[model samples]
Target: MPSAPPPVPPPQPISDLPHLTRSPPLPDFFLAALSLFVFLSSSSSRSFKLPLLCIQSNPRRFLKTPSMSFSHPNSGRTPHDAHRLHPFASPQSLSDWLKPRLPSDSFASWGVKPGTKNVHNLWLELSEGETSLADSTPPIRTVQVLSLRIIDNHRRILLESHQQLSDGTLRNRNRPLSEKMKPNETPESAVYRAVKEELGSILGDSDCSEIVKIVPDSYKMKIEERNSASYPGLPACYVLHSMDVLVEGLPKEDFCTVEEEEYANSEESSIADEAVSVKKHFWKWVSLDSLDF
Candidate 1:
């Protein structure tokens, strides 16, 4: 009977297959740092309003529309507070619920809701190993990416950009930091790719640490939580890895500015005068504590 087809292997759940691991040439320090990501919450509702995020696998119809939840950073998570989620805050509790244990379903300390969307296939593969406590211990959910934008060589802006691709554009994307990555492209690779795409250069093996600011003005939306089982039993919110990239030898191009043609200047004369394109000066970082919305 064809030997039952040799048991037909089990489907490799995306979560089980790790992406960023401690491997060759990358040095042990960088590998360790990959574990402790300084990611802020996604600025869901307050700002960065968009309609969709593209998905790679199903290019035809895998676009992620701006869920009402994703657009509002102030919406969920109960009264858990912000500091605990992002390095942007102090620890928490009602005065007594504060001990730690293995990475069991009990990790829902922040009151992160469970997975309802059933997002179970999105996989993350790393070349590094779980060398430190942080990498091996903390949950792996959304990732932290670092972008050091350079303008004219003297200035720098630690920018963050992620566009949920249109179904057909998921694999292509406005900033496909996660795709087209090399063999071991974990969060670190995402950072490098983001820099290369935006700046067009090579990032020689270097360690960048001084984070000038946290983009999106808050540690609210970047949080990686799913209302689905794909990443089930995982931390409702897993902090991805981030970095402090340098903006050495900046450029003159304005990536974030609204081109004069794309703005609201409907008047013909207004259009002509506003033709002088003004670049949006990106900031280094924003303290997570100050954000109101």
Candidate 2:
């Protein structure tokens, strides 16, 4: 008797397959600090707005005008707040709802509704270990990044620059601390790691009375590759989550600025040196009133 054909194996998800992706390396602590200083100084001292560019992803279609701010005034719900209330908040929610539905009834099949174009901004890119059924082009990736606006007890905000800026270009600036969240990491935990990684042991002593306060409210932005030339092919989408954090008891001695270095000796730099064109990072603290945005 002919035996039945060997049982077919279940197809594995794409993430299970090997894939290659590249990201800039974290600079040395000194260089990172210096870059932060340059960013804060240039940003605060100057008045310039970063230009938003529309991308033409499809060669057959013309690029539409870019609209700043995904502010949905009618909903009156911030993205973070609305996210929790969303029925499709998790893959399970989507699966449970989609399992019985016909493929033709999918959200994409429904033509975009008027004034609802901004809805796409609400969909977050896949996070680490999160899988999607959607097809992905090689090298194209989605990364979750965190941005912090650190307010110390003195009511000052810390700012840093990780990107090198041209003489007159608006600063590519961020908070003194921001990082990609690790797998299984919560936003609050990610912020704490960022502080420890960037600020060192100042907040770690047993007698330290410093208080770290996190604002429950958070903001997010979806940045497309076409919008910024810096990130070329892969990492096509950057989902930035912004937080306002407060920490007390940061001593005055630990507060200082990093000087920008024009060049570096590659022989001694870290492996991350191979991934970036700019080698410097700077940081500074500015009063709360100094923030214009």
Candidate 3:
């Protein structure tokens, strides 16, 4: 009469911070549907996963905060026009659409190409209601954190700090590249901007593209609770996103020459400086095994 051991207990709901694992491949439509459900049901404070159909190793590059607003990257098209061009049903038509067909004028109007930008937008659209839900609750703070990974041939990683260079190796040195998210900027875009600011002259247009291999997933998400000096009394939640970056075309020695020859103060310098300027920072490469816990 024990009711068959309480029917084996209902499966527990997935934890807000689920174990980090490679998400398995799922049907595109099913994945989309699941993402929509999570977005609509969860509060803004909670971290949710959007279906990542594209799998890659080293997917843990978690993008930090900023209330994301999705729009077309290409110019000349209104948001509505962009939406019309890239309807969910059309791009996801894994059947006929995937097959090549004769070119037609209609093809040109199909909208902006699917990339990181719109994919984020799609997540927003699914979870649009969460914003209102959040409005009803006590306010939660948002922070955007950007990080850069500089690795050497021995597989050691570089750690940077703004602290005095004399602090020595005992003190914690954070990964050098980090910045708050700017208005209407994506995490990856923001990271690139910071890179240019930090090492533009040395990098010399060499885009960092090679990423290390890790569990494959669409996006990396992490949530933590902590207190900071700026807002000591108030409790806080931290959302973190990080990615490994490898710069192509960098020479093995003398990363880049910094010429002391100063340019004359002129109109060109003023204009050029506005776009990109060197930032002051320090770097130290440490072996992965040598990190003091």
Backbone clashes in candidate 1 total 53
**In model 3, what are the clashing residue pairs, if there are any?**
57-214, 58-214, 61-242, 62-241, 62-242, 63-241
lDDT of each: 0.30, 0.45, 0.40
TM-score of 2: 0.38
lDDT sort, best first: 2, 3, 1
CA lDDT for candidate 1: 0.30
lDDT of 1 by residue, 24-121 (tens): 58777876666433222333344434389876874332111111222343444321221122221112321121123223454442223321211111
Error of 2 at 140 (Å): 3.1
Residues 175-270, candidate 3: write the lDDT tens digits. Answer: 545544433455566556666555566666665433222223323446666642222222345555555555544445433223221212222333
Off by over 4 Å in 2: 1-139, 153-155, 162-176, 201-210, 218-235, 251-281
Report residue 16 deviation for candidate 2 (angstroms). 76
User: Which portions of model 3 show Cα errors greater than 4 Å?
Assistant: 1-66, 70-140, 163-173, 204-219, 229-236, 249-279, 291-293
Worst 10 residues of 2 by lDDT: 114-123
Task: Give Cα distance to truth, residue 251, candidate 3, Å.
Answer: 8.0
C-alpha lDDT of candidate 2 relative to the true structure: 0.45
Task: Enumerate residue pairs that collide in model 2.
Answer: 34-281, 34-282, 35-281, 35-282, 36-161, 36-281, 36-282, 36-283, 37-282, 37-283
**Which ranges in model 1 have alpha carbons more than 4 Å from their true place?**
1-121, 124-194, 201-236, 240-242, 248-250, 256-293
Q: After superposition, how far is residue 258 of candidate 2 from its true place, in Å?
A: 10
